[model samples]
Target: MTTAPAPPTLPRTTGAPVPVVPSRGAGPTRLRALDGLRLLAALMVAAYHYGGRDGEIGDAWGSSPAYQFPTASGFFAYGCLGVQIFFVISGFVICMSGWGRPLRAFFASRVSRLFPAYWAAVILVTVVFALPWVAYEAVSPTDALTNLTMLQMPLGVDRVLGVCWTLWAEMRFYALFALCVVLPGATRGRVALFCAGWTLAAVVAEAADNSVLDIVLMPEYAPFFIGGIGFYLIHRYGSRDTAGWAIVVVSWLLGQHYAVSRLWHPADLPDAFSYRPSLGIVAVITLGYLMIAAIALGKLRWANWRWLTVAGALTYPFYLIHEHLGWVAVHLLHQDLGLPAAATFPLVLVAMLALAWCLYRFVERPLTPRLKRAIMR
Candidate 1:
């Protein structure tokens, strides 16, 4: 899943009591709690991919007596929901950052924040895993070129890395949100209109059974993003707005429907596992909503430790490279060389974190400003 860069803090407002709705110039305040939450979500995804059933390690170990860990059964099973958490967080952060910005500024900010780290991860994964692994073929020159644009799937090319699919969803969300930025006035009203229009389009696409429209509209995932927008509205403006509350309620109901459908979809269920849609799925959806709710309520404001923010910064790069690289490490050490899972898992995590930090420090931090300057010029 994709993670956004930390949002720049909005300047503090003074005089009179804080308004019910943020003024156009009102900036977003730093929320430390959300940073901690982001790190937890990233780790959850990593744990899910590494230890859950159908995971690389799980498939390799396969009911062996030596492979059992307490965490392997319960929470980790639901870790895939971390991607949903990311979508909600993305919506909240994007709304916070782009609230009063011009369309060109919003676009420039997104490209600079996303592209530098994304390009680094794409290249690193291609070199480290894609080329060396016998199981996966090296990316073709055309695919490599397409991947660099980060629009490979939309452009009718395959993703060079499996996890990059989330980036496409993020790109779509950004495109949809840009419409509000370009509107003439009342940012919140414009956003509300966009959400209402998009949700209507999603309903129409579903009714028509149009796969192309469904893909373009991304009706399936719209709820999470809309839910994020709802949380932002509630945060910036009080819960008094009837229209905002209605949007939140409708988005949530739709999101739940989409979640249930995916959980029960034939393609998603494993043949050996007689999976039923159950409380586990509900819990995942509920937990994601609760996280955003907490942010809206200021419950997580105290979570802002410097170290937590540092960890949050690592999330994007760690998420980018973790799955395939971890799988490769497990294959070589745990399966081929017979290293114990206990040792191998930690080793792989440490290596992934080290690589992530290197990418962040060397590529993301250094290149982002230059790229932003170049783009904004």
Candidate 2:
């Protein structure tokens, strides 16, 4: 049977088919590629969790030759890079859709889209873990308040959903960046200066302590957010040529290894600082900025992958529920079936995708439009 046609995206103030972006000539009428890229990223993440050894498993054959291959895990380990991709996409979408609009409308739109389902996930997980006879952390009032507000990141608190720390960062960036854009005299120059200062401060703070505040606001990811904004400007007034994208993509990939090596293993630095702690992450994010630039400039075709789009659409929900239920599923399956890592990994991944697709179609997409209308009103 043929699947029903996907719902049309609601038009934003900028006339784009989505929110959070300001389009000059109606947004790219074609985004199948970006959608596909997102799908690909989500799948990689699933693979990483199920397959990666040494990280969350022991004596589980995760250390086997096949599993240890760099190519196998590196691509997925880089799945965290999907966060950067999301940020860039958000920046473009928001800038085009919400920039220059009334703060009330913009803020409302964001709240309506992000919170309903996300909070639902939080509540679901909390309840599941809190059930009598279940193994779970004792829920505290502070934890409740923090998680509810998604302030766990800036407040330097432990994440309730664990994987949600990244969402918290995204939320904070949206709020902070929007404020910066609309502030009295929040011109491009001022915004640039502020972002630069904030990034530098985060680096300094991370150097002092690896606290949540430092990590959440660190300079490492600043460029990703900024790159989003930069992309908007390019879309608005600059060229959207493929040549530019090629340059950025090539430069980012070729330079990424050196940057990672320098940041994480600081060859020239003295032994006391050999582990230079924060640089590798920074380099990775730097690469992310370049990737976004490449996408915007049309250099990255991976975003054009059809499967990537399908997977990308489910990413948020998949991320939300996967870790919690995934652990339980793995535990039970491993116990009963004694499946090896390879088999377990693929099986769980397929299950997660099936679950995410069902939820997205039945829950998220259905509610999003109505919520958007209510918020816009």
- Among these predictions, the greatest lDDT belongs to 1
lDDT of each: 0.69, 0.54
* True lDDT of residue 160, candidate 2: 61
| Minimal lDDT window, size 10, model 2 | 13-22
At residue 338, give the lDDT of candidate 1.
88
lDDT of 1 by residue, 1-377 (tens): 12122334331110001112222233544565666666677778777777654634555544431245554544565677788878877777777767766676677777877788788877876787455443545677778878999889777786666777888898888887776544353366787887788889988888898988878788888888887778877766654656666777788788878877776444364543224355667777888888778777566665646676567677788888888777777677777888877787778888888888888788977887787789878
Model 2 per-residue lDDT tens digits across residues 21-68? 222233444454445444555554555455432333322332432344
TM-score of each: 0.85, 0.68
Instruction: Quantify how close model 1 is to the true structure by its C-alpha RMSD in Å.
Output: 6.4
Q: What lDDT does model 2 reach?
A: 0.54
